[model samples]
Target: MSRAQNETYLLPFDNRIEINPALAGLNKNSSYQTGNQYHFVNSEQTYNLFYASWDSYSNKLKGGVALNFSQGMLSGQNISTSAIGFYYSGFPIKINNSRILLSAGTEVLAATKHWAVAFLNNVIPHDNDAPIEQGESFFRYYIFKPKFGFLWTNNSLQIGITSTVLHTRDVAFSLIEPTTTLGYTLYVSKKVDKRVRDLYSRPFEMSPELVVFYREEATIARLRLLAEYTDKTWGAFVQNDFTNHISTLGGTIGYRHNFMRFNLNAGMGIPGISDYNSFMCELSLNIIVPPFSHSKYNPWAPAKN
Candidate 1:
């Protein structure tokens, strides 16, 4: 039997990384930050992401850009699919206080598939409320959505709120409603102990996050609780997601040696439902670059008189 004859179907790609300027920093003293992540699901779908940002203290500014590429395939078919998107975050504004900063960003996405054209043309309505474009082979769209949020931190407590997909343009289907396009997230973190700040000089912490998603026909909400402990050399974390009374549990262990950090994560769905009840594993590696010597002419560097 061919590999395609013995394949399994899985859920569509829904996970996304929402860039936050506050979490991208190495420290208050560091000026540059960059990282990359790769994700695999059900041994079939794969995603890659890259992001980098520069910060300036004198001007109280932060700016960055990110890219996402994903590919997946259906079982028992010659069909293949992929999507590419780019994200850009502009300079952040300081909120008059040293503990708060507001930032904004936008993203554009394009995808290719054999059935996208047919689905948009036949399945989706072309009414006044649902505006779509005519195209062949590949479907291209722009999401002029702007994301803005404020990050506040003082000592061991941190809080953030980000609004994403506030608006949409050239939407091609009614199934994609404007109200459902809007996304909101709230996150809070607290350090549990001052002495246990070990993994990489960061203390043990607990965070709870809530995300509200407006769908074309319904509003969906999800909650996640995460606890982590880290030192300079090793770290570990446990996370749980609650939705519709079902909970998924996962954990990660990581180690930092010299300039490289390695992480491994495994997760399982609770109340295993059919094909969805299975274990998922992901591996990640990050390269840490040392801080550069302060330069008077570099805008990213803090000013020194």
Candidate 2:
């Protein structure tokens, strides 16, 4: 029997001059038999990421950078990987308030893996008793990957196309093939009420959104429908994703106080032919620093002059 677990998420809202940091962990285990011998393989990974982005008013131009570090351990062997990347996006042309934007990014990564060769030799019988000299304990490599994308947005509707890992160099220690293909997304959202008030004297609104994602590499598509209700101090949302004839339900709750906001989200996978018992949880915090000036043009300015 084998089991694997993974979790990933990207910030949903658009922000100018935003800074975000996150951490993730994964675990997988499997067992196999070679002839009369049986072996178990267990792997674990952890990642840390820091990202910062800035966008111009009306979202005409944007740029960002990200730094990532990851470590993986499999059967006592350890591998480490790190990357730094930058991206630029802009709406070079616009028509009647409808805009089209192009974005491109690249990342440079370095990886190293350390293996225990002598320990492996003891586990598996050798044909000859000849002494085995200790070879290189570790190997290092590098990779460069590029990404490009385009987006078109008008009012409440948006369409986007993106390509990732356009150029990827093979890593000798990698356990899985990198996904290097094109993907598409569609988003539509609508606000239910524009004139409700909350306890904090802030506008209360409810928005429902539908988003779809498709990947050419796997010929797989997923659809998500979400409804969010928010005020100045708190917000909540419920969403569901439909894929491969299965649906997953999830919800989020968030609170804002002073300059900081906190959010918590969780999801559970629904069962199909095989009983599924998978669930994920995530927590995030955001800090807002008001711009120095109120002019919409200067994001760093205070709103009131």
Model 2 residue 102 lDDT score:
65
Q: Model 2, 1-305: lDDT tens per residue? A: 00111111122321111111100000011111011101111123222222323222222233322233223322223444455555555534577976666666665665544345546545555654442232233444455656565666555555555555533333443654553444444444454544335533325545555544444322222233333334232333333333223244556566756655565555555567213334434455555444233456776765451
**Best candidate according to TM-score:** 1
After the best TM-score superposition of candidate 2, give how far the Cα of residue 124 lies from its true spot, in angstroms. Answer: 13
lDDT of each residue in 1-305, candidate 1, tens digit only: 11111111221111223434334342333233334434333345433333433433332344433344434433222233343434433444544443665565554433333364456556666563342343333342233446666567666666777676634332333354433255566655555544434543435455554444432323334444445455332233332322222234556566756655555555565555423343545455555455455766785777563
How well does model 1 score by local distance difference test?
Answer: 0.43
Provide the RMSD of all predictions against the true structure, rounded to 1 decimal: 9.7, 11.6
Note the clash tally of each candidate. Answer: 10, 9
TM-score of the candidate numbered 1?
0.54
Error of 2 at 42 (Å): 12
What is each predicted model's overall lDDT from 0 to 1? 0.43, 0.39
Off by over 4 Å in 2: 1-81, 109-143, 173-202, 209-247, 273-275, 288-305
